[model samples]
Target: MALLHRAEIRPTKLELLSAWLPGRPWFQGEAAAGVERVAAYRFDDPAGQVGIETLLVRAGGGPVLQVPLTYRGAPLGDAEAWLVGTCEHTVLGRRWVYDACGDPVYAAALAGAVLAGAGQAEEYFEVDGHREHRPPSMVLTVDGAWRATAPGLGAIDRVEDGDPTRIVTDAVELAVVRHVGTEPGPAGARLSGTWDGQPAPLPLASAAPR
Candidate 1:
């Protein structure tokens, strides 16, 4: 399947980001500030239905932090509740509006892409007050076919060990045990990690968004 480009997305995803950027916890702009797109790119999902976009914007003088997102319309409902705004396309006569990161579909798509060797390893040193500074500090090797290197304080190492996925990290003192689902969608996989020697299970849905 062909990768979805920013131009091909109805109404243009950049226009949507112009309105969405200020609402994120990681956004340093004023509460009602407006944003202008600096650069953007798209990732191709093997599953053609999901759309993934990586956007970089300039909101005054703040450093540029990458915002990766996925889009979908199947079972679409109440997307505007978390929506930043709408994108208007003069030629297409259509508008595409969506939430930047609160959707499960987008989150799952992003995780899937990272596991599929389609994500680039990078780090964000600065972040807004409310947001956590998650520098890329973990290394993930999936099934010996793909490797993801991350850097930072709380790093997570993810590896697929037969039926169960194992995550080991000394920085945060956690061991994650995951159960991969037989199917896709919201029920893709389940993950549980032991932090500080305590058992904590993170549902597949929760791990992606919040």
Candidate 2:
């Protein structure tokens, strides 16, 4: 598998973020403002084609924002509909950009990285607040179930929990602590876990922003 070191990435991940962050709904930056990279790291995939990155960006006044993204070749076909942002890769010298969340392959790689301890939760926060921080714990189940719990949010709110009918992706991780389970409904197959050793609260949005 082709594993890229942080130093090995072209155009630098931060450079990519400078152009990418502004477009995100969670981004709290002035239009056209530049973003600086505070720290960065990557998780390796057994297959070299897909890549996962965890990046910290300093966009002026707000607390550092952690953006976890995946990259791949081509348009991801039908998945392009949910793309966060795409641009020509001056680094790889490619013309297309892709969002991993929309790509099953990238999503699975992210989950695997979490399982491999390639990420930390200290830097994670709600996209809107940009200040509230989530802890660094993730829950993985053999039955294809998962969930996420931000600071103050209580036990695993099922994101997806059911039979392991398909192996759409290999893994998933929250930069912060999240719960995993196999249930249904609003809390179905969700993220749930503790923050700073305390039980997470519910409605992750209710907790005060860090």
Candidate 3:
């Protein structure tokens, strides 16, 4: 279960993304008019050391763009380029946010989600000492091409940035689609997501053993 504390966050998520999204080479819309959060989902880190979140935001009414992010308490080594800037989480103090493509935890999580059938994490909100389960903003489903062995997600080898971010790990290659409405996904096991007002399932990612 993902526990969320009722704390104020400075430079709000949207504010931070607005400044960072436009610079991305794969980004297609203008962030000047402002970005709007369309939906979001998350996966849990088995070790509970990092937070993995995928945000689907729209800029200037353009197609929803997919941005996977990881939240950590400290900077990731040699990942300054993927850094999305830091934010102060009133209760959690300072947080270093980085693009998920460069974060091994996220790559592993995505690999499991796409190849092992693992889905989004369940979330719970805490306030005034009371905790309640919170439904996910978006729902995801995956094609479980169950294999005899689990993915060897030990280390990420390389990452290629573009419309669909490519992540190559020790045992699997996962591609994360950047645009929501892109048709026909990658080959092999894949995962799809759906949100309110969405007519059909949108392919989020695909994975194949390396």
Best by lDDT: 3
Q: List the residue pairs that clash in candidate 1.
A: 136-150, 136-151, 137-150, 137-151, 137-152, 138-150
lDDT of 1 by residue, 1-210 (tens): 232222444445655665656555545644344555544444454455655554555566664444545555442465555554444444333444444344444443434443333443233222333333333222222221122532221333332222122223333111112121121122222221122222332222111211
* Candidate 3 CA-lDDT value: 0.85
Best by TM-score: 3
Q: Each prediction's TM-score against the native? A: 0.44, 0.47, 0.95
Evaluated against the true structure, the overall lDDT of model 1 is 0.38
1-210, model 3: which lDDT tens digit per residue?
Answer: 678878888888888899999988888786788799999999999889898999999899678999999999999999998999999998889999999999988988888788888788999988778889999888798775676434778678888998788887787888888987774245788889899988588898889877
- Candidate 1's C-alpha runs over 4 A off are 1-15, 30-33, 71-75, 90-95, 119-210
Question: Which 10-residue span in candidate 3 carries the lowest summed lDDT?
Answer: 143-152
lDDT of 2: 0.40
For candidate 1, report its TM-score. 0.44
* Full ranking by TM-score: 3, 2, 1
Q: In model 3, which regions exceed 4 Å deviation?
A: 148-150, 183-185
